[model samples]
Target: MDFLTSSTHLHITAWVVALVLFLVGAFVSKSKGIHMALRLFYILTIITGGALFIEAMDYGMGMQYGIKFLLGILVIGMMEMILVRQKKNKPTTMFWILFAVFLFAVLYMGFKLPMGQNFLA
Candidate 1:
């Protein structure tokens, strides 16, 4: 839809909300309800991210966008891993570290890319 491609608001909002949900799921509560909601936001984030990826291809920056995409997936995977391991009462120090690193990488690339929004640049 035009609204999706017109801006990155949806993608940004999805991830931001997901991050909040992740925090709640990870620290405040281990309820399945929060995890399920987080999963849904993950889907929303991916869909909007895919739209942006496709748009980036038109600019001949497929390689960079592709890397960003992979990093995004890693971030998502790390989030899921942290929550699951937390629920299982296992230590997640490494996963938490990786999550922060990957999330930072993805966000940096997102802002550095030649998109409608580039707050970092």
Candidate 2:
């Protein structure tokens, strides 16, 4: 468990790969295999994120980490909605918009957090 939560590298990589998977699922293919892979990545991301949140709580900023977790979940939900809607031949414009907004918020908060890499912070 310590190994999983020791650093942010794994967390970052998981989410980044999930983002790429999202992009591929968005415009490239609607294959079930891709969707399943994306879902797997989502789980990996949340697990890693939870580990980070526990670490962040040690900094005495639980609220910020909580908000980040919520936003991260929203981002994941939005991704799922977009892909599902896309498959159903439904409009995903709003989902895409929300995804962008939530993703930006989460990523910004991530970089601004104490444990973050001080990326553009």
Candidate 3:
């Protein structure tokens, strides 16, 4: 119970939930319900990410935090482009590639990288 209230725990929980939602959304692309769920999931992701950014800034992990924030924004932008642009094969392929790179970067920052070490430590 106490762990649930800890900042590090909360951050991890948020990221895990976001990642799961992203995977589910991607896999269930044929369903409108899943698409809507993805939108809501993304909203939660943004909110939690913003909170983590603020915490990082306050504690002096600014560089890592900034990088993560930029990556998140880029991912969201690419997704928006994919959704709004005409359904053409070339554009769709390009968008998916960009999104894949963005996802990789986000995972690196969120997991493999030491971005949140200061807070977690």
TM-score of each: 0.95, 0.97, 0.67
lDDT of 1 at 19: 95
Report the Cα lDDT for candidate 3.
Answer: 0.64
Candidate 1 global CA lDDT score:
0.91
Tens-digit lDDT string for candidate 3 (1-121): 3333245556566556656655565544545575566566567667767777766665567888788888987887676556545323234668779988997887677664454445334
Q: Rank the candidates by lDDT, best first.
A: 2, 1, 3
Which RMSD values do the candidates have, in order? 1.1, 0.7, 4.5
**Candidate 2 lDDT score relative to the true structure:** 0.94
RMSD of 3: 4.5
1-121 per-residue lDDT for model 2 (tens digits): 9977888999999999999999999999889999999999999999999988988889999999999999999999999999999999999999999999999999999999888889684
Error of 1 at 59 (Å): 1.4
Residue 71 C-alpha lDDT in model 1: 99
Q: Can you list the residue pairs that collide in candidate 3?
A: none
lDDT value, residue 12 of candidate 1: 90
- lDDT per residue for candidate 1 within 1-121, as digits (tens), equals 7777788889999999999999999889879999999999999999999998888888899999999999999999999999988878899999999999999898899889888466876
Residue 68 CA displacement from its true place in model 2, Å: 0.4
lDDT of 2 at 27: 97
What ranking of all candidate models by TM-score puts the best one first? 2, 1, 3
**Consecutive 10-residue window with the lowest summed lDDT within model 3:** 82-91
> If both were scored by lDDT, which would come out higher, candidate 1 or candidate 2?
2
